[model samples]
Target: MSETENKITFEEFRKVELKVGRILSAENLPGYKKILRIIVDLGGEEREIMSGLAKHYQPEEIVNKNVIVCTNLEPRKFGDQVSDGMILAASNDNGRPILLTVVEDTNPGSQIT
Candidate 1:
């Protein structure tokens, strides 16, 4: 069950480093049950993240799509990919994956809050 929302102060909210990134490439990682190895370009720098979105999107389909990422999180290694950030996405009632896309034309690494 989900808990009630806890609103935080601006100071607390500012600690989260949410940045925009463009998907440079995506490919199915062999041997994984259901994960896509994605490269996202935060301006000029590229970072990798393993997303369990393969069930909803083909690897090549999401290329060039700008996405929001939690960039300040600790790095995690999944298989050969070192995941540096998390790709934000939503789940439907049935749990289908939905990428959290940018509205308007936000620049890469733009502050979301």
Candidate 2:
């Protein structure tokens, strides 16, 4: 496919609701080695999000970390847990998940754009 074919239109990209959220707590999901159940504070609302970060990060290590979250994504179920939003991350050369985080202190629920 050409580069243009793989690119998304600006209008399409704008539909994604990206917000800053602070991880309040993280825990391993039962029966899943790669998934973690996390509670994130999006301003006043706390959302439960399931992230594939257990392989790369300890639950205690990510607590209180500010991360980018796609808040408008439809909720997805993994086993018995339902994820309300998605935590944004990138893969490294080794294919390990590296979470996308804000460099400075930003208020929770702040728009990413």
Best by the lDDT measure: 2
Residues 14-109, candidate 1, lDDT per residue (tens digit)? 899888999999998787868899999887688889889888899889999999998888998777677788999999998998899887877777
Predicted structure 2: lDDT = 0.95
Every model: Cα RMSD to truth: 2.0, 1.0
The residue-by-residue lDDT of candidate 2 on 6-81, one tens digit each, is 9998999999999999999999999999999999999999999999899999999999999999999999999877
Q: Please report the TM-score between candidate 1 and the true structure.
A: 0.87
Model 1 stretches with alpha carbons more than 4 Å out = 1-9
- Deviation of model 1 at 108, angstroms: 1.5
- Runs in model 2 with CA error above 4 Å? none
